[model samples]
Target: MEMFLYYIHLFARNVKRTPLFFALVILTLSIGIGTLLANLSMLSLMSTDPIPGKSEQIFNVNMNTYAGANNRFGSMHVLRYSDAKAILDSKVANNATMHYSSMVYSRRADSQDLTRYASPTRATTASFFEVMGAQFAHGEPWKNEHSNNIVIGHELNVKLFGGANSVGEKLELQGKIYTIVGVLKPWEMRPLFYHASEGKAFDKTDDIFVPIEVAIDNNWAVFARTMSTDSYTTLDQTRQINAYYIQVFVELLDDKQHLAFQTFIDGYANQLKEKGNHRHEVDNRLYNVNEWLDKNEVVNKDLLAFTIATGLFLLVCIFNANSLMLSRYQASQFEANLRRAVGASKKQVFFQGVVESIILGIICALLSFVLAFSLLALYRQLFDELAPVAELPLHMLVIGLGVALTSSLLSTVYPLIQGTRTSLASILK
Candidate 1:
């Protein structure tokens, strides 16, 4: 109890001598560490699917090659309806989903408010929702029997009919009127595969989705072909869909089952090639469950780099704090010698120095928390336009506190040892 009081007195005296330097060291260290943690949190949230399902079992199947008179560079790897039917009928995959893209036009009650712009719209099967782990915010997705039904995104509903409950209402798409069957939740816009080829971010803000059958009957193969002069014919087409853009996702029982499924797909692709059905050749690149977890390599690399840099920066701050503490000890040389001469033991001096460092560390941690929160609030306000609803998770706060405490202890070690080594005889002369 008596030793504790002495240590407290020593800490208070040291802090009173150098408040500004202490605050600077804490602020710099906190900012560097806090920013790194915030970025890591964001990356983690974005790369994960919110739905509770086996997302790893899902695979994107594509036909990667085509045979023609001349090798074409940008030829599509899509299969036709017949080819998809054959694959699905074989039950080689756990589930098969077909998709196609088209330009959809829609309008509101007021023709003036109506927009007729080209949007990359999708025509997909009902299993698409299940495969991608999407849910309806209001109403349900279209049934297999409902050919003329449509489901719109939340933002699209607002733009077309100005309400969320636009279900059962009629909307015109591609010069055809269809009843709105469902409206998807905001986050359901994930796994936008179309943007993969376009090299752009898929904003689910404004897109119209409809049944695959309706799209095929109404939009697919509805192109005009113009013939040229001479015996050789030239075809000028507006939209020609020669193949089907379908992806088959499978959910196997175990690792062995997964490998078996991949081998089956490989064998199937070879069979298609042998049969000259090269357009339906399956791309055997299977993504297993573990691979999905580590999909965001860029994000992972960025987070790691940020963490390493932050750790280094904090180390530099600690070294600076230690240097400052050393200089202060040098100035108190006479005082330390006087105390030692008065019969204070080396252990007593060492304990007092450690206690002083502990007090300074606690003060720095509290100040750092305040500064980190302030910086995060500012960041949120500034980037509200870009990531309006993004936030740092609660776990990051715990991590930040751990980092601060650890940094404090490491920084104080050298200074505490140096302060304990002062000699009474050399200083008292």
Candidate 2:
């Protein structure tokens, strides 16, 4: 520790002598490290499993159901309402659910005001809450009354029912009276891993979660996919075999369940093929949370490109740091000669140089963290794609420190080696 403190003191003195040069080196390092960290933060946020415990169990379902070899919907990422319903009906997995995004207006039943706001909704099943680990702050999910009962989120509860429990309270949605059966706790799933394909991955939690049957019966309009074989006069027509617009997911744990689910998918596709209605190739896919995000590219591609660029910039910064350190070490040749003459060994000089590099790394890391925050904010502002992104966690300080120390050590190897290996007699002359 005493040796380390002495090295630190020497490092500080060197920096005090060449303040601007050291400052520039630190700034260059900060820019490189900060940019890299920002992109890493985004990648981490988008790729994290939203449902950690259930990610392995739950799988997103995809099938090529479109007829004809050149159909646009062939090899797409959605299923027909009938296909999704069939998968759920097969019960091949432990639990399963499908949902589609919709907008519905809601108002307090007792309110005399004619005002209402369009609520973003999830027309899902009771199993959805279980599959997604959605916590309930109030009542439980409805048992018998699926259509007439609704689940409201925390913000919606505050807006409609004054932040009360709101269980059993009457709320009117799309001109139909429904009882609030449950109120969700504050829920946020970044990249909305389950619904990434629908373009609502970063959207706010749904204000309403209604039964799929209720959503279908009430004719809730869908904003996601709607591929059709023919024009539909009624909303029910879209729910037919020809129209494909539902997102399905199943929870298959053991190999038995997986095999069963896979068989179900293949058998269903074969049935359609045998019936002469299916023309496209049979392509059924199942992806977990991380796989789903990867398949859908939830992480912004530009951010990934930026990551690679920042890595190269960091390499350049390291080279620059190495060059600057070479100059600094060369400037201390007189000191090195004097110390070597006073019986300091080459090993001691090398250790001192390494300690100085570590000190530089420490300073660089501290500066980079502050710069990273600013850079991240600025980057998010400049790129609209990064809007509504999650921020880096406080624990990223450890990562920054590791990066800085590793960078400094790597940058200093050649310069320090040459500086420490000087001939004492030649230098004394």
Best by TM-score: 2
In order, what lDDT does every prediction score? Answer: 0.58, 0.82
Q: What TM-score against the true fold does each predicted structure earn?
A: 0.65, 0.89
Checking candidate 1 for backbone clashes, the offending pairs are 79-244
- Score residue 78 of candidate 1 by CA lDDT: 49
Residue-pair clashes per prediction, in order, are 1, 0
Candidate 2 at 315: error in angstroms? 0.6
The predictions' CA RMSDs to the true structure, in order, are 7.0, 2.8
- Candidate 1 stretches greater than 4 Å from native: 1-16, 38-53, 68-86, 100-112, 115-121, 155-164, 188-207, 216-248, 256-260, 279-283, 289-311, 325-398, 413-429
Model 1 deviation from native, Cα RMSD in Å: 7.0
Minimum summed lDDT over a 10-residue window in model 1 is located at: 226-235
Candidate 2 Cα errors over 4 Å, as ranges: 67-70, 110-117, 158-164, 273-281, 343-351
- lDDT, residue 392, model 1: 60
Residues 281-332, model 2: lDDT tens digits: 7888888877888878888787888789988999999888888878877887
Q: In lDDT terms, which candidate is top?
A: 2
